[model samples]
Target: MRTTATSRPTSVHLFCGAGGDSDGFRRAGFDVVLGANHWQKAVDTHAVNFPEAEHLCVDLDHYDMRKLPKARVLVGSPICTEGSPADGIKRPKAAPTPGQLSLLDEGPIADAAWERTRATAYDILRATEVHDFDAVVCENVPRFATAWPLFHWWLQGMAILGYRHQVVSVSAAHIGGENNPHAPQWRDRIFIVFTRQSMRQPDLAVRPPAWCPTCEQDIQAVQSWRNGRTIGKYRQQYDYRCPNGATCGHRIVEPYVRPAASAIDWTDTGIRIGDRPHHGRGPLAASTLRKIRLGLEKHRVPALVAVNHSDPGDGRAVPAHASPLATRTVRIGDGIALPAPFITEHRGGGSTTRAIADPLGAITAGGNHHGLVIPYRKGGPTTTAYPLHTIATRESAGLVLGSDALPEDIALEDCYFRMLSPREHLRGQRFTDDYTVLGNGGEQTMQAGNAVPSNVAQWIASALLEVL
Candidate 1:
């Protein structure tokens, strides 16, 4: 459990998905109230988990902040799919080429969604300021902070409200473990922390009681984060890794293990081992896969596309990168590297290509299959050589790769064979063992996906607590 500095607790939350953000503040000894989608299930989840506080299932846009409970800290994370750049915009990227027009520059649905989402965020920030929350924390995809215009307005609003603030993109890798090993993986998330300005810079920011950043092997590193943006030191990501090395490969993906419902890690209620995949798992169901893909396209997040590759092992098959039309090399991560990509958020959630590789004829775009492929490389069909890292030259190979692994593995509950359960994913998000997630039914898995990772909330809460 984290030590709380405040004599009294803080209270505030918005877009409070299953209480991931709220869990942190509460852990930091804050009295948190929640606001989020009016879905009965979500509201119930919040109420059940944090019964000591209020959980309002009202639209933040319609609710008046003045009428809401006032507390020292406020926090939130809006729906990311609607605003993420990962979703392809209806607008074309870059300047228009000849007769074509930029889709984002012209489309209706795209423009409406973008404007409404950002506007909503701006309204909430303004309202929070008016209500006098001492500190504010907003979480979102790293791109969300930069892609929208309204965020600039937030800075202005903070200036008007007499608060100093800063935004940093942090990742789950900071909380990684040997079983997790998601370092080297990059899934940039933006965390914005702000504190009310007091007496115009006369007060020195509270520095932690610590020893040194210049310490030796026998000592632990001491550090601090400030809302005033004193990023005089290296960023967190840099601090987490070996500066001389290449990417660590593992990154933050969807949480796969559920945290304990209590602070103890070894209780009977602690995470039970379940199915998680290694390599060789195939795509999830079609509908579920589509949601992630469509979500990415709509949000403008980039997708991998196979351009040219060589398959030295296989004789001649490959499939298209999830990318539409044709593009350069498709993007994929080795399982040993980054945090695994998120499983579909909702059940039966769809595929967005986990691994894309090319080999001799295996990785060609000729087939409808996804994942690794062996493509026909040099020479002709009889004499060609394929590379393991890619598959391209020709699109068609005689057979598909190990897609059967998915069903068989998901069917079982063994090591590296099982599909990631909702519980595991929640754990990945960093939820502590305690935050309760109430699902609609008795199915714990559903509840896990629906809720936010408690650890992420902990990070935010810890930062907010530091504002004292």
Candidate 2:
């Protein structure tokens, strides 16, 4: 029953899981005409969220692109797990540390899967030829660009198709809390926007301004940073050592620092300054802070260097600051450490004298068996303690332990670990409370994790609008 916005540019979303990206496009004033995906549950959820759009629950490889409606913009998020660092082919050459290694070799299977996945991107490009779309936006993990022949082939194909492209890496958390409070989860992703040769190449370097808590201002935060000499800038052996080796605090290396690509220095000084939260803001609630830390580690983002904490009840102790365990140190003389009195631990380990406190000081997904322990604080709501934010997977849901339960909340004790209800997953993904997530817990979880953050999608789409 929805009427088409004839005046607006139309967009076709392929691999449109849960329609978060499409939601952004709609917010950006694009008429989202079609959303196609392989998963019926995802398509069902998309239909529920975007009931007006034409929903095709067919696999992209089989879908007929020529039959699709003509549109000016095309956006796709190809499967990332196959091309991600999480994939086996991209596994680090170094052996994993104890308790770190994943036993399965996802590479060969993933590579085979990627062969099919990469086809979706190429298929979109081919459709571009027939449809003559004005622009295309593709997203995936930054590691996607590192996939062997696939990356090279993709660029070649783009060149042949007459599109100019640029890739920008961004994080949902650093996108700024004030404007995007809905998507505080820390997720790093890359966006590649390409314009047809006939169209004016847009300056796709545009990024959302980030709020600096310390400065109390919105700043054009640098999106990426590079430090140290550029690779392949080979100099003679004698030229490698620093001229001021004795006085210079930095290590002696080849004498070239790439022009600071960003206003924010990648140097340790910049990291320290950039990482500080806003002034006068109360420390993130202890339970919330613990989840953030665990999430950051999971995402491989740098851990927060300092936290406002209290001593643990058990004898286990930890360093007051995020130093000592530091492999590389940046001496930023900003001595502002705010106080949030909550239990603390160094590296989630207990002190030698005392066993690690119950509901360990550092929060993690823990293991499959126990799930995460909701920590006890003096006055906060006890019901929702730990694993505070629901992740995309059922395995990522919060679990409770009987020992960690209080006398009053004995009812929840038997429930022990519990998966986040569908509504919670939707909220974590920044979806509105009314948004419907189809299917059982497992399928819904996959859809949630795979969907792009609507805020990020809107941010990118809005920026693309200026260029388009």
Candidate 3:
């Protein structure tokens, strides 16, 4: 723990789940002096990792920020269950989505939790007014900004506090880029950066200002694939291009698409070329046809690599990884399935037979029967929500085995897969190895899944320094 005098710009973290945000700021030289969270286990974990910071196990609903030591910087991640799209709360002002309805079934426990957690957002305003901090950072799901009156309230509150704020959606993976090999996880979050009128600097944004040219072409190819709107008319346009000529357009589609699997699923029966499914491009080469057929049967994601002589010309639509273009459809259920390396199998206690759960379901904070099943000689799921704690011991890390060898192991039947350990989760969040998770597997898993990746926090911290 590094101690600092009052003269240094100090930071206090609210809702500090396992201190991932503070760890990033600490890495960037911020004196993270204090933190407060409701979960005792998480607070204990935060204390273990950030020994010097004052950790308080207090609920934000009734907690007062002024009672604590004052600091120049304030950072927080308000409870997101009520605002996260994943939780089925699509619109901020609307009642809980059906998915969220489960919480309401438990009477006061769920209802009260929702009410109290929802108010945590206003706690930021309270901290700003009471502490007179020079800057405030509130991190949460992107929907937090547009969740009905919530965004309006945040904007109005900051205005009352006489601070100007900017909301930027940043990707942790993009910020880390190629330099930080440890920071490849795809995590996107909305950061509301507020600064006192005194600081002078341009606002910060990690999103690329421009893309490569070949990437632009790829984007057009994807846009045209959309049956509804054309790429030119689409509002959110990316201008970046591949630095290399057409030969290397990998970067264009890299960030948007998950890695390829050996097999894939196509949307239409008749193979059409060009962006529109109707526009025909004569006959594809026999080799191209063979690869497409093989990819579909083998469950492999088609390649979007650099265009080669054997490749179809630019602007032509081909069977490939699911793209932003393919995602845009008039009908909700209409979409193609890309190749997957493995299938996610939720473990069951019974013998002989078990069922697979939703592939992209929320990774709850426990080691229950949930795990992934990697295909033989193929790959695994693209999503990172699955943790490494599928097995009870550390030796299981990176150990893929057949289910028949251990007949009782239901998650691994015909395919082979391994659960990611808590340490691996920390790495995905860009936390240093020394950072400790002080609890059982469930508590630790929750901390990792719910955390705002530290890499993003570090980028925001560095940006905050410029304004301060």
Candidate 4:
């Protein structure tokens, strides 16, 4: 640890699965004590990665908080299958689980995940209040707070305490990660950032100023995010650190994505194009397209680079990697004078690790996948539809993307097409090739596709930390 603010004494974690948020909080300089219930792999991973922090495997519903120490920050990720809207139209809490519904089946994994999360959240909140920690950060499926009744109660309960909840949605990339290189894997989630409002300085406001463009987009996207949405639409950059936390001593790597364009929506300015200097332009960029005389191409990108206009006496300085198109499989570029718009997310995941698992996807080499297009309609007869191989819709000219996604441009078969593999999807999500991309084939593929691009994360996190 850098012995920074995260090194404080009061930090604690409940239902901390897989330690994603824990790592961010740790990087932010807070000590972390992770707690979880049947998440064995996650607990093991947390211990392996964060040995400095204690990992308690005991169930929070029964665990004694007095025996444990306190911390400044509290983080939790509640499971959402049961309470989430994605699971289906709401189910009454009283509905009988397998244990109650049948004498034969005793275990219900979905029910267990949901109930445990609730128990853990309540326990953490109460215990943290007991300790009077400075802040509490609760993370989970974005809709969990809105869909679950008990979640609503927890929010109200937290309000009664001195802390008022400030729900802020963040991308994994902003906290420091890589961007997906190829396809867009949108993972938007809602987090409840709670702190003692009175204790927080006015400048530490989590809500960005009204002028921040990203904040405006987030506000606009909330409604699109409500009901079930699509998967793998947007992805942001994220990072993996080196032995030292300082960037001066580190090498940063990320995916080679279709970099965001610098062009702004000029419509807002109300300035006529004719009034502008760059006029009589078929999209100034298109006019400058390098035409290959004999199919031999030449030119700068469609305005990827804009020459700086300088006085006759002053020389215009070109950037270091002034490109001829970078070839690295995974490369990240800082937003030039032009700040990139956030990768826009659709109704569902919204370009973060904010995933809601869908067991209904096709059987890939990995596990099942969830997506925009779903098969197997409820109560519908066995209609004349075979298993789909391609997520494609033919447009007037050629092929355009379909509900989910089609197979690779080079895949041999059709109906046999599984959604993009994790590696390809990782590439699609804008993660660099150097990072040790992980997942056990299908599961690994899902993991990579579901993760944020590290480069993007580093940029966003750095911006956030500077404010801190």
Candidate 5:
């Protein structure tokens, strides 16, 4: 370890895509000294936002850690595709026992690739051996515990090196409240902190009181579990109980959820759905059209809705402004619904839409596919009420009205559609507008999707600071 001194606590981040971890550490009062990553684009993005810090575009698996400078904290987020469910690779049900071959059934080449990815975790251990860090933090998908066969031994190695570690499973959506900035996207991650001294794990879980629309009252929120197992996805697992109990017959109560509507730019109304070209064809895929119809069917009012086109559950539509968005992945699979009547102009003459009803789904490093569907009148503005009809084509649709009419009353021909921009994706990730994201559109999306939400990182850093 180098003997150079610093005024504030210093940290070094590995696999530091887009510098999300570094940004959080900075917010928590740490001087992020260095950020290293394997991808040149990611490193470039990090360098743009954190010009003060030294950046290295090198693979940690092969780099010598002894050449690195010493710091108070060492943070890393290893590549998680191998362990992530989105990749569709079958993960080991449990860590393999000694002398057992993990992923052998997948084939030698596949097993080798898996081993290469899994070995990234060992790089953290290698770094620990070379540096005398006050604390070491590693973030990854929760499945990392069972996916990497050497996970147990990795912890043992840390203990042998005189560090006590604690692993906590947390969601970004649950890390903020009245006193803290909220992460709009619901991302579930595991944070492992290893320190020389034992410390109490930071309580990052926050369940702010939720409003039960049905009960029309504030209620305490509790975790939802069935048969002793947690239910629901992301932060939705925490729900509110109506004071009226079973009599009220309202089971869909949700905790206070920050919506993704705050991140959208309504000025861009997007193109008409019928005009979009798909696969060189004149219109969108039939499946996509079906999703829009389904979304309109579910939400009949002039409210923003999120339609998860890629969801295994039949492209479900949820109110966008009511709950936090789902986790962002490398690919954008979620779409939005905007009613033309709701997309009115503000007093300043700037176009604005009603608040979104649900949070944006996970952003991925690949590209964004989050499309926007806007409902508008077919010929022009008309006061005459029309009967509800299924969305068929762009020429036949109209804006969805209130409960008096019904969502199906709107025609499909009146709807407009377009994919969300990269800047919007960054906003959902909780990155400030001023934070520069350098790269092509795809690169920017990748950086945003791969980033650890700065708020979550800040919370973890603050907790670590207390014990440091």
Candidate 6:
């Protein structure tokens, strides 16, 4: 076990999906003594990455907390799907009954299984009741705050157990860089810390100014709040703007926010849209085709475009080179589009994509839905430059200048499309290159989506270490 200036602090992670949090804690110099989860595959992945840590693949809901080993810190990312807005389930309008803490005797929630899953928060209480840790950190979606009353009740339970808690909202993109690792994706989450000792809240404010390619100047962030509450619903609490009055929109200037282009493998240019048979699907969906065309028109060059298949309004094409990818979900929502006739080689290669214009989006537990689009050139060997590149071969390859072609001139026959690979998704999640993710493509994607950005975890762990 790795030791710090004080000593090796032990941590136990509950609902440790693929060990993203575990990995981060380890990096922050904590001894991750145990990781517990319900899914066997998740357990196996955690085991593979953290062989020294003991793992339990049992349902946390039914498992006896008394059996868990004692540790200095406890970390948990309870099942959040039931409480997430992405699930599409209408949340109850009424607050949960004051004293009815048991899911079996639920008053407001109707779904028993969802109640059980949501009750996982109470599992932290259960664990604390079993063993008194120095501190406890619980991570969940920002929307999890919507259950204010129940959340307060959980805090009250902690207070009764002699632990004071603080709720802080943070984004992975805003935290790490320089000497620390940073996730390419923009994921906003709330970390509630329960400490037995009194310590000021950890400083989770945005770290430094980011370069605004649009404004061509370094921009800072302006935090938005109203009457001591966050300005917008869900993840908006983590967003900030430049106080310097930069005209480049009020987007958060995250210098630490890495781009999606860093995660893409240009050599893996997917199959041509025209060549691949869609079987009975009848050519790509009109919506998808329209997105591609729209992307082409918007970019006006051989560019990387993300075609979102889920919500049309949300599905607008983004220049892959200039924008961080939108959140990755379990369902295949976003797809990549490229103008056609571009040759691809089996060996990996780089593209001429530029920095992402927007912040990276959150990754969910479903699967990789982000897609890429590339422009295809008709003839001759093409080389990587500006926005496009052709397959590398023994023959000399040069820039194709496909941008000269107007969007109107580009036809459906001129593009290629494919989903982003799982490895790329993992990169966006900030997992190490040596990290092993076991499973098929879909499962791997699911694990990546579910994972906490390890860098974010490391930041949180490092902060907790100072206070612990």
Q: Give the per-residue lDDT digits (tens) of candidate 3, residues 276-308.
A: 223423333333333333423433333222211
User: Can you tell me which runs of candidate 1 are displaced by over 4 Å?
Assistant: 1-6, 83-119, 176-187, 199-417, 432-434, 440-452
Evaluated at residue 1, the lDDT of candidate 1 is 17
Worst 10 residues of 2 by lDDT: 255-264
lDDT of 1: 0.39
TM-score of each: 0.49, 0.57, 0.59, 0.45, 0.69, 0.72
The per-prediction tally of clashing pairs is 85, 5, 23, 63, 32, 28
Rank order by lDDT, top first?
6, 5, 3, 2, 1, 4
Scored by lDDT, the top model is 6
Model 6, runs deviating above 4 Å = 1-6, 82-119, 199-201, 211-222, 226-228, 231-256, 278-282, 301-360, 380-408
Q: Write the per-residue lDDT of candidate 2 for residues 75-169, one digit (tens) a residue.
A: 89764654333234653233422322121211111222223332346666667777777788887766566443476677678878888877766
| Prediction 3 global C-alpha lDDT | 0.48
The lDDT for every candidate, in the order shown, is 0.39, 0.45, 0.48, 0.34, 0.59, 0.59
Candidate 1 weakest lDDT stretch, 10 residues: 359-368
Evaluated at residue 408, the lDDT of candidate 5 is 43
**Candidate 1 lDDT over residue span 1-468, tens digit each:** 122464556667776656766765676557775555545555676787778777776656777777777666667665353433323354322332322112222212212222323224565566666777667776666545555556677678777887787666454333232332221112345666767776222122222111111221111122234455423222432332112113322211111111111111111121111211233233344443344444223322222222221111111112233322221122222111111112222221233333222111011101111121111112211111122222221122222223221121111111111133233334544554465655422223333433444544564565555455
Q: Model 6: C-alpha RMSD to truth?
A: 11.2
Worst 10 residues of 4 by lDDT: 292-301
